[model samples]
Target: MKKVLLLGANGQLGSDIKKVFKEDIELICLTRKNFDIAQDEISKLNKYSNIDYIVNTTSYHKTDECEDFPDKSFKVNSSFVYQLAKYSNENDITLFHISTDYVFDGMANEPYKEEDTPNPLNIYGLSKYSGEIAIQNYTKKFFIFRVSSLFGESGASGKGGNFVETMINLAKKDVPLSIISNQYMSPTHTLDIAKAIHYFIKNEIQDFGIFHCCNTGNCSWYEFTAKIFELTEINYPISKTTYEEYKTKALRPKYSVLCNSKINKYYKMPHWEIALKEYTNIKHRKI
Candidate 1:
């Protein structure tokens, strides 16, 4: 049985990954308390020398926080990733790192391809891009998945829960909510990503490089919010607004829809609407 070490196991994606891999592989999950991948030296990981793979889901991805502390952002996203890559190379462990779609400038009319040039618009994007470069430079046995707009049942504690939860809570207040319509992206389910990871591992993937992994289809935040309301039958006052009207500390790509043609070679991705429907169903059962 191949042993896999997963970082940030308590996170939205990491939580789901655990569920997906529990019965299939020898999985070891590490939260920040277990080991701080960012602050801890690479030598600390030597104890797990038997690990066959290291899936890094840890990231400093808060847009505002990244803007506030560029050093921390790079430390967690770039420097730490570089260390992992270097260690993976020396240890003969396969590395799987999660990245973001923010690396693009979001000016493209169509979805971004694997070969697309990254033009980060904010500190968060720049830091993630730096990690991507570091991984490419330091390791050959690595899989970099650039995904966008993740929502999961676990709800990222650092981000104050997932976007769907935030929207539901806001709707409960019965106040007028102005959501951005200018920025578009392919919102994905964390569970789907987990399944994709399982598929890759089961298939013993040969192609190793950056792959755009997101649910098919795209929509603006406004459309996404509207769909959420439609699914839940929640009567909430939602107004569509532009990015200019939505004041934010960090700049986001106006369009960050990533093409899944590359990953499709291994697994087919469901459309965003389908995943959203599934999420709502699971959410309702919990309530």
Candidate 2:
């Protein structure tokens, strides 16, 4: 079995990648404890010289928090990625990195395609975009996937849990929610992204560049919250608020939905609704 070294192994996306990947592919899972990006992490990977592929799900992805700690954000999101890209290049391993849809300014009415010019609106997006550029420049064999609003069973790494969990908690406690109606995005599941990556590798899809892997359709935060309540059978009061009223430290895109035009023919991406419903169903069953 070919060995794939997975960074951020304990994060929501990383954990699901562990479970969703084919049994035939050997995964060398390494969490923050084992591979801290803040430290000189490239030196740590010298031992895994035989690794065929390196999948990076690591990020300092607290959007608002990133605005406060731009240095930390760039260190983890940009500098460390450059190091990983360099390491991947030296080792001749295919690198797969997770990115954000925040790279866009959210001005487009339709879904952003892979070819869209990235105009990051915040430090987090700028840093992630820097990482994307680094990977493209440093490594010949790499897949940079731009994912948006990701939530999973394992919970997010940087942000507390995820929007779903936060919404669930507030709804259960009878707390009124004020969701943003202007900012739109595709709320994707980590497992779906994992499955797509695994499929591409297993089938040897050499079409490597930046791929936009996200759930189908886009919705404002209010609509997303409504769906969460519907799936979990939670009736809660949620009011729609625009970006102007609901202020955050970081500037978010008004529309940041990613189109899977490239990967759709090879691996079908389920709609956000179906993915969300499936996630809720699985979590409920687990609970």
Candidate 3:
């Protein structure tokens, strides 16, 4: 079995990836507790020899928090990724990195493709895009999966909980939801993402660069919330508001939905509605 070094193993995506790789690959999991990507040196990786691949899900992804701590965001999202890419290049290890669809400025009327030039409006997006470029520069054996709006069984470590869980909790409390209606994105399940990555590893697919790994179709945050409420059988009040009406510290793209162009050639992605329904059924015990 091929050996894989999985970083950010405690994160929602990383956690599921571990589940997917169980008893299949020779895996070495590391969370931020064991190896801090920002502070810990990549030279330490020299201890884990014969690492065929390094799946890095480590990211400082709290968009609002990134605005206040640009240094931390860049260090975790860009600088450390650069170091990892360099290390992977020297060690002949294929690197798999997770990225966000927020790299786009969100002005596009249609879904953004992998080849679409990135024009980041916030520090977090800029840092992630920088990391993408670094990987492209330093490594040939790399897969940069640009995913969006992830929700999973394990709530995001960085954000405490995912939008789906938060919406359900708020609805259960009879709290009125004021969700953004204008910002469109592909709200993907972390399990599907893990499955997609596993497909690549299992098949040994080498067609690498940047691939948009998101659920098919798109919806606004309000629409996403409504679906969650529908699935969870919560008939709560939800008001739609634009991103400007509900102001945020970080600027979000009005349409940051990604088109899975290259990845479609490898694996077919389920629609957002289907993925969400499955997730709710299996995890939340409702659909």
Candidate 4:
């Protein structure tokens, strides 16, 4: 079996990948305790001797919190990723890194293509974009999968609880919800992402480049939340709000919906809403 080293294994995406690929690969997941990417590169290289692939799911995901902790965000998102890319290049290991859709400025009316130039508005996007640059400069065999609005069984906590869960909880408490209607994205399922990565690995695609990996369709945050309430049979009163209403330190893009044309042509996954229905039905015993 091929050996794979997964950084940030406890994270939502990492955990889902772990659950899916544990039996097929010799999986080694490292958290902050086992291996700190912020440490020196020499030490990081020494810890993992012979790994075939390194999937880095670790990220400073708190977009709002990043304003207060820019240094820490850069360390994990940029500097550490640079070191990992260097190591992967030197060791001839395929490096797969997860990136957010925040890298784009969200000014485009259409979905962002892989060739689009990134003009990140905030520290988090800058750091992630920096990481992407590092990989491009350092490694020959690297895959940068950019996704957005991820919600999964494992990512509930990271994403401020799953969209469905939060809506259900709020509904049960009889609280009215206000979601942003202006901000748009194709909400991705982590399970589908894992399967897509696995598909690429199985086919041994050596063409290392950036790929957009998200569900088929797109919707605004308000529309997405409404869908969650609809699917869960929760009649929570949801009010439409603009991005301006939900002010945060980070400047989110007005529209960060990624185009699936490339991934669909190469490695297609299911539609966003369909995947959500499947996940909710499986987990909540309803479709």
Give one digit per residue, the lDDT tens place, for model 2 in 23-88: 879999998787788876588899997898999999999889899999999999999999999999
lDDT of 2: 0.90
Greater-TM-score candidate between 2 and 4: 2
Clashes of each: 0, 0, 0, 0
Residue pairs whose backbone atoms clash in candidate 2:
none
Pick the lDDT winner: 3
Candidate 4, residue 274: CA error in Å? 0.7
Return the lDDT, model 2, position 4: 93
TM-scores of the candidates in the order shown: 0.97, 0.97, 0.98, 0.95
Write candidate 1's Cα lDDT for 1-287 as tens digits.
77999999999999999999988799998899979976788788899978889999999989888999999999999999998999999888889999999999989999999999999999999999999999999998999999999999899859888888899998897766899988899999998998998888878897999999899999999999999988888877788889878888898888999999899878998999999998888876532
Q: lDDT for each of the candidates?
A: 0.91, 0.90, 0.91, 0.85
TM-score of 1: 0.97
Cα error, candidate 3, residue 181 (Å): 1.5
Model 1 / residue 44 / CA error / Å: 1.1
Alpha carbon deviation, residue 164, candidate 4 (Å)? 3.3
TM-score of structure candidate 4: 0.95
Q: What is candidate 4's lDDT per residue for 107-204, written digit by digit as tens?
A: 99999999999999999999999999999999999999999888777654356666667777888998878889888898998888888887777677
